[model samples]
Target chain A: MVYTSERHSHRGSRGRGSRGRRRRHPEPPRERTGGDIARGIVRGFGELLFTAGLLMLFFAAYEVYGKQFETDREQDQLAQGLEDQWEQQEVRGPDSEPLPGSANSRLYIPDLDLQWVVVNGVSQEDIRYSPGHYGDDAVSGGDATAAGQPGNYAVAGHRTPGIFWDLDLLENGDQIVVEDAENFYTYEVIEERTVTPDQVEVVDPDPFNAENNEDPQRSLLTLTTCAPRLNNTHRLIIHAELTDTRPKDEGMPENIADMAPETQAAAGE
Target chain B: MYGLIWRVLPGPWPVKLLLTLVLVAAVAAGLWFYVFPAIDPYMPFNDGAVEVEGG
Candidate 1:
């Protein structure tokens, strides 16, 4: 490289002369090719595919963990209830058909007119039992046995006022009459408490006991509702113990039919 | 095979860009029209979802 003096030239000024003096290294503006173009596109598409996969994963997690878990529980119960109902069909009626108007299962209240179906399991379909609010699939009755299992069965309902219509008015000691084929189980409310949602131990099969304080004996009934009325911050629990078991012939009210229409198909009548 | 792609890119940019776009559209359209509809039923398009509830 040669250094040029700052002498003015005829072509305008010293700046033009300086540029002319500098060496120029021009190389055909880089190379252009078809393959290079294709690669960029493939790269872009790969990125799009990766993004799509992430989105799909998010949706799958939402369905299983968030949405389906809350409401699909009823379907689980229905399947289980059907299994139990079918296995226990050891007797035959006059028609050789399951009895009609027998309240597929019955619900009774001596204090109020709140006799409804145990409705197999509490799924999204059975929201009417719990103030019309459906639960996802994962939420079990909490205490199925105490509510009215073979020995102890449990039931849960919504407690929103003007919502469940009947369950909302359920007070402490208020009796819940459960009528199955053979007998009507009368369970009396014994205890009530407020617990956080994660404290699921309260609804365990034998959450309470006297022997080991873990092995349960009495037919226990459990009722659950969103605490503080409408808010779900906590669960308002009502615990009841079985008081007496009377033959359905004696306890079933004159009003309730032997079978409800919903159970017509299940009863096989 | 990969070298062929990188080599072409260094030669020209616009033409490569066009080919990339065409390949993507071809793959996507083929899968969507010819493949997806057959398996759509297995997807979670439950029309009765609203009515069925938990059970």
Candidate 2:
């Protein structure tokens, strides 16, 4: 009787051990405490927010710096194209009309070490690769030119980089040299002002009066960009007047003589 | 979510690692191509013009 009972007990223990080792029925989910559930939900939300925040940071960095790479590359191509166009046998005269959306001139700001090939037209497509001239027939009612008739040669660009970013650093009387195929026009900053984004009147040739559409009495240069650096709510405008104009064949202007080597290298000399 | 995926996957370490890499690549591509672009307009990346009536 002792031997039989011992064997039976051993068999029962073996069954219990197997049951513990491998549960036959799936376990019911544990009853989570209210506090535990709340914590889990908060953690999940926090994780989601963290991921979104990281993505936003990456995007901001790309917009600020990465976009510059593309703009620089486009500038190089545009510069090359402009150089090639000038080298061709078909030379344009001083009175030739400037076409919208076409690269027409080079703007050099020695004070800020800024230079860019200016394209005509202020359309988004036109300004994507370079600073765009505010065309006369623009729906915005502003006008710009490089070597055409004497008028406001207003241009718009982004304030981030590779454009008019350091425009604010320029004070009154700074020289802004502009050159096209045939002539160099030097302008001096006369005024600086900040206006709301909607103040399209600032770009008008007669900024004081929108109704005054008479011929421009003097040549003007207007540089416009988003102000306060990252904010686009306001526009920073620098108004300048043509101080000197000389034919390009007369050679590089005295003001930009120091930059000749750099300019030449940039033009792929 | 990632931990749950790891538990559900049935494979040895090497196969699981490879699958994880591919899964990561797909997620990144989806975010880059679709998710980010959808959120772009809401962000202030563009320096687009603002219209102003004469004042």
- Per-prediction TM-score to the true structure, in the order listed: 0.41, 0.73
lDDT of 2 by residue, A77-164 (tens): 7776676655441456534555666776788898887788888677666776688777656523433444434667778877767777
Candidate 2 scores an fnat of: 0.15
User: How many clashes in candidate 1?
Assistant: 46
Q: How many clashing pairs in candidate 2? A: 1
> Which runs in model 1 stand beyond 4 Å of their true positions?
A1-104, A128-152, A160-171, A210-215, A251-269, B1-55
Query: Over the stretch A1-269, how does candidate 1's per-residue lDDT look in tens digits?
Result: 12222222222242323363333213121222233456668877887798689556654554334333333344334423543553455444422433221113545565664434445444433543222211222223422342344333545554433223244456777776666667667777777777776665555555564232244555666666556553456666667777777774564443334433434443342
Query: What's candidate 2's DockQ score?
Result: 0.24
Q: After superposition, how far is residue A85 of candidate 2 from its true place, in Å?
A: 4.6
TM-score, prediction 1 = 0.41
**Candidate 1 chain A worst ten-residue window by lDDT:** A1-10
Chain B TM, cand. 2: 0.71
Misplaced by over 4 Å in model 2 are: A1-40, A84-100, A139-144, A208-213, B2-47, B50-55
